[model samples]
Target: MMNSLKHITCAFALAALLALPQFAPAAEAADQPQRPILSVDGRGTANTEPDMATVAVGITTYATDAGKAQNDNAWVAGEIQKAIAQLGIADKDIQTRNYSFRPTYRQDKGHENEINGYTVDNTVIVTVRDVKLTGKVIDAALSHGANEISSLDFSASNTQGVRKEALRSAVNDARDKANVIASALGKKIVGVQNVSESTGYLETRRFAGNMMLAMAKDVETPVAPGSLSLSANVHIDFILSD
Candidate 1:
């Protein structure tokens, strides 16, 4: 009877040990492997004519009297606002960028001296929704006492759509590159494990410095917003299988 009781106890202990395995932690029991991953970089580009432009127009008024300078600046700013409205630009699209009153300095002999004048600068940024009207808007601003054309930038009105398309193209390019590399190594692509993307636009414009702004007086300010290129670069890690 003692021998039979010991045998039954041993059998129950063995069964309990076997049942414990069913409750084991998944993270501890999962099969994991570390291996070299294939990384490929791909780039994609898409170009479209810019649909919108941002123009900075301002009046720089200088006079010996501070009150006169302030009054003149206000007058010119009003004219610019009126001109912008006449072109169908809504009030919301026109924004005041800068308003300042500062003393002017001039060269007196070999030293810099403070001139007897106060300069008032009033600037506004306007978004021109139509690309074809860029030149006309510039001309109108200049005629309306806008002495300083600070900057002109071209951009797309619907940037999100362009960015999405560029990203899709970049993904396709990365997959193609991975396929080529895998094909050369006699391995097939199993799956894409990870992907990252970097995207933006490059702006190249005609505005440079004070001299360029001065040169606008002689020319018709021929602005050629040829084509804006939106680009995307992607890095992908793809798992391969034999």
Candidate 2:
């Protein structure tokens, strides 16, 4: 009986020792301290002069015959295209933005259900590589039978450099904010755990309403290709240390 009791006691001790590894890791993890983290958002902007411009011009014509209306519109559109070409605009730079051919309804009581005439509208978007030639492009279009001007917008041809600068500025801003917050909490940023960024640029738009008036007065349409603002926003996860 004594020998059997000794063997039973030894077996119990061995079993307890074999089970220790499973629970040991959990206890060790519970005792370890967690690292601190700081999250911040930053924004930055860079301004640059516009190098390119886009102009949208339209031509409208009406006639009793649809064929005649379409023919007149095509003639005027061709003339405007030629005029734009004279100013050095390439064929690829000119694109038809919109075109429509529809019959107009007579508003008179007896003719209410009758078709009065056919109207044709043609709109084209012209990309001006030279910002200085924007006004000339508009004037050429108007002089060649373009009756409506929809929009004029300005942008920079090369924004990659500007965008990089803006991103750098945004990262610096985030670092500065993190340092401020960490310092107040009696801690310091040791490393960046993760970072994300988004970038965009805003275009400068010119009013098209006064363009015809300016042309009527026989003065050069004044255009200002103002500065473009490129912006970047960043979200950073900074590791903190005491």
Model 2, position 97: C-alpha lDDT score: 70
Q: What lDDT does candidate 2 reach at residue 10?
A: 99
Clashing pairs in 1: none
Determine the backbone clash count of candidate 1. 0
User: Candidate 2 — what's its lDDT?
Assistant: 0.88
Candidate 1: worst 10 consecutive residues by lDDT?
203-212
Tens-place lDDT per residue, model 2, 1-242, is 99999999999999999999999999999998877989999998888888989888989999999899999999999999999998899999999978999999999788898998999999999999999998899888888898877888888778888888899999999999999999999998898899999987655656556754665356577777778888999999999995
- Runs in model 2 lying further than 4 Å from the true structure: 1-31, 201-218
Q: Best by TM-score, which number?
A: 2
Q: Rate the local accuracy (lDDT) of all candidates.
A: 0.81, 0.88
List runs of model 1 lying over 4 Å from the truth. Answer: 1-36, 105-115, 201-215, 218-222
Model 2 TM-score, 2 decimals: 0.81
